[model samples]
Target: MEVSKKKPAAGVPAAKEPAPTLASGKYTFSKSEALRRYLSRKQARSGKRVSKAKRDEQKKKPKFVEKPFNKGTRIVSLKKRPNNYPCKNHSKPRSKVPKKHGATKVRKSLQPGTILILLAGVHRGKRVVLLKALKSGLLLVTGPYKINRVPIRRVHQKFVIATSTRLNIESVKIPDTINDAYFRRIREKRAKKAEGDIFAKKKKTYKVSATRKADQITVDKQLLRAIRPHPDRKILLNYLKSRFGLSTGQYPHTLKF
Candidate 1:
């Protein structure tokens, strides 16, 4: 910002205008007189915004320290508010464990490298490897989809069957499981990079045809054959046959993934 002090008539005092500081240098100048006014106004408006933001941020209540419970204490008495309850209402709902509904209890705990059969979802009954346990108590499993039928994704722990086979895959790092917010942030970042017509049009959707289905089966067979060892393939094949009567074609079968 530039400042101009107009000279007063002879023997009169010169007009006063302060010099621009380093921080308030974002002003646009068309004329010296306008520049001084613009900088002063802009600085004042910005300072007000900064102070308001800081004040609003400070207004948020901090998480209070949890104190030990004592029956004699007024805050902890059961007749009043208990020590376990929170003082403020949270915006998000608390997570709850689903009620047990006679679900089969597997004694084995799932671990990385564990091969599991998906008991539910689109890839039900297909074999997948547990890449890692997710933060949300779900299993991050993958079928190595390019080679196997199962696409990489997080699966509910309840819907997976822990198979006895555990292949060694500790060498690879599993990517983090993502939610909608993660993708939304990515889209916002990309939007900020360019303003108009920057994004490509969404691709069209299509229904699966018999030919696509046939091709998928062929791909799954080729991928499984190339990836799985002779012994492991034999076990998976036998399991599939026994579970679905694949050999006799007595039961309905689904697409591999």
Candidate 2:
């Protein structure tokens, strides 16, 4: 049997087409329609007008009022106290003229090799091995205070000679005078220089081993000993051995006591 092919009538409406589906499976609105809907909601929110009763109530509210200043009231002024004022209640008490230890008595001038006691300066109460008395009446002591050239006036009168090797002393106060300040600055600078020197020495010592290789010829242990001759002997020896291919079993014969 032959099938007949026929066209639909022009007056009849075609069958409704199925809606297109996106990956999200949601119905999508046209750009213009979506924008129109958004603008409608914005207009609804912004178009609200203030009521006349609310406006009247706002107008009736009180405003901030400024108070008048009184000219007769007194104002107090604050100022800082002077920094040079002596410390309260800690002033050195004046010593009464003793029957035995009379005031203004000329004691024998301190000489070289005399162990003087530092009574008042930064190294106060500390017994220093006096090197020499400078023309300025200052003592040349060893250690950190030596660089400052601290004056003899700072030392207390309670100094005794160092007959034995061991000595014991206490710390002292640093004066705030101009001379003391100058001395302190000099001490600080010298300390920094000393610290730099120590660091430089350490750097030089460390550089010796770093430049050498394990397979290279053994280093002269005498040269290493001259560089550092203290408690770090073992450490330096081990480092030299590792760096210069020295035999592990061989003791470092160049180390001097």
Candidate 3:
């Protein structure tokens, strides 16, 4: 029997292409000691660069848990770490701020002819009458100058003690509450008047400004009607007289323009 050494003819199956090499553009398959060391070093470097990746990922994060906000309630978050006290990791606490002035302050509700007793200053213990709520929430009070000798002026609600007296406004001439600008102008005019005639002069006119007329109007007619006169007028008058050395005049004196 004889064997043929010639290459396999086309009629027979070609030998497998020696298993095509598995190589990327620049690298070939390798398993040398240097290659192993290079891979180990590369992995070690990557691990060092992001050493905290796992620990940080495991660290708890604040979640947007749904919560109901309360007006007077507060909540704080705390973190616990190994070997450190819980308080040590805390952020600086917020400082408490005082309430807004408008919120902290209180204004007394008043109406025309509400009797008030002075609670502070030189007029302490003196009884007066509330004319109206001025533009700045101050009460316009008077002792009717002619009657009780207390002049027309602005007084804070904090400085007066309110009385049960509420006089009828049906005939009371309530002057419109003048603003700061009006008072400023009046002050300037008075100062100028005190100075020489070369200063500014006012064109006096009796016709009232439209704004003044509007302010004079009652804010709520129903409220006004509901304000009944104090039942103990005689008793209150007697008390005022006895306490502050006052006089019960023949008529109720009100502050008017």
For each candidate, give its TM-score against the true structure. 0.34, 0.18, 0.35
Worst 10-residue stretch by lDDT in candidate 2? 214-223
Give one digit per residue, the lDDT tens place, for model 1 in 30-70: 47877777777897887743566777887664534344567
Task: Report each candidate's C-alpha RMSD, comma-separated, in the order given.
Answer: 25.7, 30.8, 24.9
Error of 1 at 78 (Å): 41
Instruction: List runs of model 1 lying over 4 Å from the truth.
Output: 1-108, 175-257
Backbone clashes in model 1, listed as residue pairs? none
- The local distance difference test score of model 3 is 0.57
- The lDDT per prediction is 0.57, 0.41, 0.57
In model 2, what lDDT does residue 70 have?
82
Return the lDDT, model 1, position 214.
52
lDDT of 3 by residue, 1-257 (tens): 69977898878987764423555643344558548767777978887544567768766566334444675544444454368655665677677986544522334446676777787877777776676776566777665443444555678887766666666655556544453344443322334346657546776655555664454343223223434355765565554443343356633345321
